[model samples]
Target chain A: MLTSNRRLVVYGIAGALAIGSGAAFAQGAVAAQYRWLTFAVFAAIICVTMYVTYLAAKRVKSASDFYTAGGGVSGLQNGWAIAGDYLSAASFLGIAGLISQYGYDGFMYSVGWLVAYITVLLVIAEPCRNIGKYTLPDILAYRNNPKAMRIVGAISVVTVSTFYLTAQMVGGGVLVKTLIGIDYEISVMAVGVLMLAYVLFGGMVATTWVQIIKAVLLVIASLVLVMLVWTPYGFSLPAFLADVVGDTKVQAKVAGLLGDAAKNMTPQELGQRFLEPGLYFKAPIDQISLGMALVFGTAGLPHILMRFFTVPTAQQARKSVVWAMAIIGGFYVLTLFLGFGAAKEVGPGVIASIDAGGNMAGPLLAQHLGGGPDSFLGNFMLAFVSAVAFATIVAVVAGLVLASASAIAHDLYVGVYHGGDIVPPQQQVRAARIATVIVGAVSISIGIAAKGQNVAHLVALAFAVAASANFPCVLLTMYWRRCNTGGIVLGMVVGTVAAVGLTLVSPNLTYPKAVRAASQKVLDGEAAKRSAIEAALASGDAAAIEKATVDQKALDKAVTKAKDDMKKVEGKEVSIMGLEEPLFKLKNPGIISIPLGFLAVLLGALLFRDKRSEELWPEVYARQNTGILASKATSH
Target chain B: MATAPKIDWNAVIADPRFQALHRRKQGFLTGLMIFSVVFYFLLPIGAAYFQDLFKTKVWGVVNFGILFALLQFVVAWGVAIYYSRVANRDFDRMAREIAADYEKGG
Candidate 1:
């Protein structure tokens, strides 16, 4: 034990250093911003969290604590942890950016996210807690069917968690690089190292506290920012919101972002416009698909489901959800205020100049509220909010790493490879800790690879997998007696295939290339025409001048023609991959894939009905219906 | 894990008391799930199919769309809190009773 522990420590330190050194080689170039205050705040946060981890490490003596914090977490604590876990940097920054840029359409994600908890609360929470042990597939394998189910379960959990982990890492890199003069790769490594440390030593207990602390910070920051935004108008929320919409500068930015529909409106009219839909989500199908993805996608998120195991008893699982829903629901409402606050407080011009993606709205708003961007207080607030974002990312990434690692170590390694009874507890825990380092390192590398990528789309695709592939299997296992190995496998395959297939050919992948090339061609032609005119002017000939001016008209005509050509194919079904048109147009695949996922389960059950599935029903039912299996539930 | 619950769950499942418990729990859970599906989908569906109606302003700056969107969070919270209360009072109690009844060979 002593020797292995020493080896583990050596590995942990080596992994941490590897992650730290990794940030040195990333492809990020935006190192234009730096603030010592942000660094100080980040250092302070690291100290506090390291202390929390030390506390958690001392207590975690077994696999149970490593995976589920010994199932001793309180409902309220779990609630906050879930909120922290659920509200990724996307929720903190992206949703606010969406609302700031797109008006009411941005809040759609928040609403969908909040309501998703109802599905978890009502359908998944109690059952998942009751039927499973360390991982979700624990429930699927509880009835003597571990081999295929565990493997599939492990794969889905790892896939979803890795995607989530990658997104957090990318966001971390972008955020840190933007806030301070660090390389994006280095920032990603820093996040990875810290995330690894948390999972490696502290396990679920430390991860839970990290999340809870971050959640508190996030909510408090949002609340403070909202108050600062509203206080300027004497605390009349209506007046402040109207001012946010009514600001002439805001109108211009809105017009620029969304076109003329948002331009030249009176305060009342602009307010109404902002409140109405269609700022970002232009199509009916797009909005519906996004909504479907957010609602169903959340249910299958491995990190979120993994949280339920941290609390003992199915009842606490149920209670934690209610607590989570309440906290999450309130936090989302506050995010609306944060969105509006950032829009009004920071202003979009500053937001865009800092980051074209508008990701700087929250931090900029913090700066603006604390006096000005350069003020001591401004830097302080900015640093505080930035640290909250860092904590948020770290907390979420830690959970993802822990979960996927457990899926590997608990479900696949011990439960599947070693069969049910072969692997010892100590070995399992050791494997899980090692798995954390491996998963964290892998995600950090992927994070470095995806350095400058738009993580929003990646997150959406992850959601697609979660909803269609992961959730369907989990739902089937919990509710359907007829759902056998074949049914589960079919559901996962169809769901994953449909989602990935649709996304591959979807407008998301196709639109950028065609649009960029077409628009860039027009700009290049216009630039050439202007330079030729400038060349003609240098001759100082009256005839040349007149000829050049006349040629300008032709150039204008050419530009018009170019624009017309681009418009004709703007969103048309044009082949993305050498075909006449892309096979899929919808940006989100959830609406199609989720139904396909369920259909596959039905078809598989009917077509390949397992003879022993009926025989296993008694045991499955027993596990789900009572607390009697609680001991067995904890065993594996 | 040690000494599996000796109660005959097959018999318990067949018992009317267990059946009632299962029926009640399933009914409530399924009912909430369906309601959530419809309730949550309405905003997206309404935004898609009934844009004009959703755009209609109910207040000075607030439109039906924003109101409906915000309403979802409220309704979701209401459903969660309401379900929590109901489950604590009803479903959990029913489950405990059924378990006890089975153990006692009722």
Candidate 2:
């Protein structure tokens, strides 16, 4: 390992060089009034995290140290880190926006996310800690053909991480651009470089600390907003919720968003509708499908699973998960108040007008709570929240980079290429740092290329693949005695193919141009009819005028019907085949792909018998349960 | 880089204490796993089929659905805290003893 002093000098020079170049490149004149405050907050966050990374860099000595902080992370610390790693900008902002706009459905949407940890806590966390070492493939390759298992494991981890990373990168850039007027490409590069620095120098220690800091900041920021919103109702949740569902102003504002759909409903009816489930999701199956994905998919996410290895023992792993559950569960619960609070105070129409997706609801609510945007307090709160959001995205992306890098360097480079035998630890750590750079570069490129595209579906796609592909194999490898190397490979391949294939043919792929043309046709036809009616009325003959009045009434009704149809079609997606409707109806593939994955594993095990794998079952079982031969904490 | 010491894993697996610890942990985990899974899925199922039932107000503006959904967070924390306690109290003790047996014998 490099001496701490030498490493410090190298990192200092690199940091100085980066700061100089970043200042030169980010000199674009941003128009926001509070741009200076935002930049200051951003700089402060970076400096603190980099300092933490510098300290962590001194401790990273071996491959294990680089990957798992030498297994020295306490249960509480790792628990907070997992929360930091798990709650991306999506959960913090996206879910809040959903609830703010969609009402009760949005709150319901968050329940599954919290409950997902039950899977992680009950089924996966302790066993994962007892079984795996550096990467997830460690568990799979233990009793099987190590080479094939490692190769497949690396591929799956990289694939899942890449999808997840792209979403975060794009979201980070877009969020920064919207909040502080930074250029999207520049912001993406900045996020990539900062994440690379964390993993390259600090490794898991830096990444974990970064996550902990971000998670704490995020919760504090959210708590502030929730408290501000609830203060009006004397901090009573029931009173706040009562106003959300009973207030005439809130009901009217939300009902107006539904347009003609709520025309006949009374204010009380609309208030009740606001707290009902069907307001956002027309189909219940979509909710159920997404729920399945979140609940199962969380257990299989490589980044989340990697957290367990940071703890010393299975019991610590279990305790860390419990801590994570409390924090995560509490955060999701707070989202209920935040979402409804925004709807109550900021108004859904106002939130939607700012960002159609409501991604800015949290920040916007912060601004509204402080005052209006014109006030200094409002702008300051906005800047603070925007900074926290930036930290959130960076922390998540850093974790993603570490996960993919470990999979590549630990599983593929060391395990597969070197046959898990003679690779030196320092060289392995070097390979991991190199892998981090490559993963960061690739994700940055993908994020830039995918700029301005609707990438919301990629998040769902990532979860679905994790749930279907990785989860089944990992679950079976531990629980099923008959599961073998052939079974794992087949299960991963089949599950990945099924999930991706279903998404490809599903309504996720839509012909926007054609939909626009169809809507234009309706508008144009209506315009022609309107001119004809005008001409008839202008002729000033009593008979023709009377006839024109009747036709005008009919035309008005038809126009309203046509406009509503167009509105519905605008949100609905079509398959890439140019079909008006998708062959596959469900947006998420978890309900279908998960079972197919399990079935494929069964089929593969029955077809290809591996005596060696069968013979190792006792050892694997004993170790996974009792932690007899499981990898121990690395020595300094 | 020390390799793990070799021991008779089959014998360890056959040890009565090891077997009992495994059995109890698995039984408890399986039961909790089933309960949590079933309890969790009820959210979507209730939302999908029994909309009115879920909408029945329990308190001021807090409907059965919202209450039920919020209850999930409690249940999750309860499951996690409860499981961790049982695992530490009953399971971890037994596992340490079994591991100690092997450490000495090997």
Candidate 3:
């Protein structure tokens, strides 16, 4: 315990050192923009989280406490923590930016994410908590041959968790770079170290409190910012909308994107743009696909599921989920406004200049509405927003790291390597910390490689993978009576491969390459025309030949220039125009892939169905009976 | 020819701490669930109505969603606490009663 405390302190100091060095080296807008009060507030939140972890740690008498908070957590706390875990930087920051840029299409993410909770309630959450030990593998291997099933389960867990972890790390780097102007790699390293400290020293106890504090702080910050936006205009919503509508650039963009017909549309029509698909009638199908990806991907996330185990009962699990959904749903709705408000106030040109992807919309909006970025109030708000974004990344990454570490140490090491022999609790904790370091290193490496990529898109890819791979296997094991070990293993592999393979080859992945090629082609054509024009003047010829040659050159130049300009405009227009269709098509492949996984499991079960002992059915029934009795006996 | 297995009441109610823990957990859970259900339904509508009344547009939408989510979590926490207290209390009482009966050889 002392060692754990000491390690936590050391890790905290290391984080401060990293931040301090980065702050000192930062230049221009970021250097003078540091808000001491905001940093202090962020630090205070971390300290509070640490204290919560200490309390939890004191109660951790067994591996159960470390892994599942002894299954004693209340529904409300667990619910908030789960929400905190699920609302990553992508959802908190990315959603609003997306809404601002894409109109109604962006709201699809919120609906998809919120709806996933229903699936969780129906299929995965309660059953998983009821049966599993520390990880999903325990549930998979519950009745079937334990050895092979455990190994297969571990592999699935590692694959999904690693991909998800990479996305969080990449987001962390971007958040830090945007907020503090630090080197992206350094920011990634800073987040990795902080997360490593969190999981290694504090374990789940630390991770949970960090999430809870973050959720509260995020809510408070967003509310305060929204209130401030209203304060300057006497708290009148009509006045605010009038101001937003009066902005010429915002009006122009709205008109251009929505068409002339949108100018006369009602507010309800405007709001509905976010809710219904096909509102952007001219947009490609990828836009619709992107919307679906955001919506469905929320259900299959691993970090989100692990949070349910912290609570004691299935009922608490259910209630907590309800709470998490409400909170998450509310947050996403706010993001839509934040995105639009920033676009209206700051102007799209400025936003595009700062970050073409629009991840900085929230902070940029704060600066525009509150004061200029250099003003004291503006700087403070900027710092606060940056700190919130940073904290959001850290909180989410910590949960992801813990999930991966548990999969390795608890599921793989104990379940597979030791043949499920009972290991001492202390040794298990030690192994978990070591696993954290290994996962942390891998995350840092991925983050470095993923620099300059869109964090949200990468996160969506992670979601697609989780939905296709882990969700099917876990869902089937819980609900399907005929599912055997072979079925679970094969389904996980097939789903994982299908999702990853499709995502790689999908038009969405290849569209960027095509755009780049188009740009190069335009540039090359211009160069060739210029060289030919210069050569035409140098060559001497007969009058007839020269006249024909000059005419040909002029004609060729005119043709080349027209084509080049067209290509340039087409490249820009098509890049934007082609955006929605490819993404929508790419995203749906997961829906098909997920069902395909179920079919794989069903087939495997049928093939292996006859091998089942009659004893298996009775044992399953007995376990259910005992579980019910246990619940009743305990619930006074 | 066949005998039913005897009930192990002693095993069922052996732990003294279980009752107190169970009761506290139940009370906490009941309160939490009630709070969550009420707030979850009310808050989103409240936020939406408030946004509509004020015409806050983008900020209004964002706030409504965020507040709803936050309120739901608060309710979940309340429910979890209620269940934990009830479960601990009932289990402890049963355990103590069984232990006492065993001591008396009843």
Largest lDDT belongs to which candidate? 2
Give the alpha carbon lDDT tens digit for every residue of A582-606 in model 3.
Answer: 5435544555666667787787777
Q: lDDT of each model, Cα atoms only?
A: 0.77, 0.82, 0.62
In terms of docking quality, model 1 is medium
**Model 3 per-residue lDDT at B26:** 45
Residue A542, candidate 1: Cα error in Å is 37
Per-residue lDDT value at A118 in model 2: 89
DockQ ranking from best candidate downward: 2, 1, 3
- Of 2 and 3, the candidate ahead on TM-score is 2
Candidate 3 wrongly placed segments (more than 4 Å): A1-4, A22-38, A53-61, A230-243, A255-297, A453-456, A510-513, A517-588, A610-614, A617-626, A629-636, B1-106
Model 2 chain A, poorest ten-residue lDDT window?
A23-32
Each prediction's DockQ against the real complex: 0.63, 0.70, 0.05
1 or 3, greater by TM-score? 1
What stretches of model 2 exceed 4 Å from their correct place? Answer: A1-31, A246-249, A512-514, A517-581, A631-636, B1-3
Which prediction has more favorable lDDT, 1 or 3?
1
lDDT of 2 by residue, A463-486 (tens): 999998899988888878899999
Q: Give me the overall lDDT of model 1.
A: 0.77
Error of 2 at A230 (Å): 1.3
What DockQ score does model 2 reach against the true complex? Answer: 0.70
What docking grade does candidate 2 earn?
medium
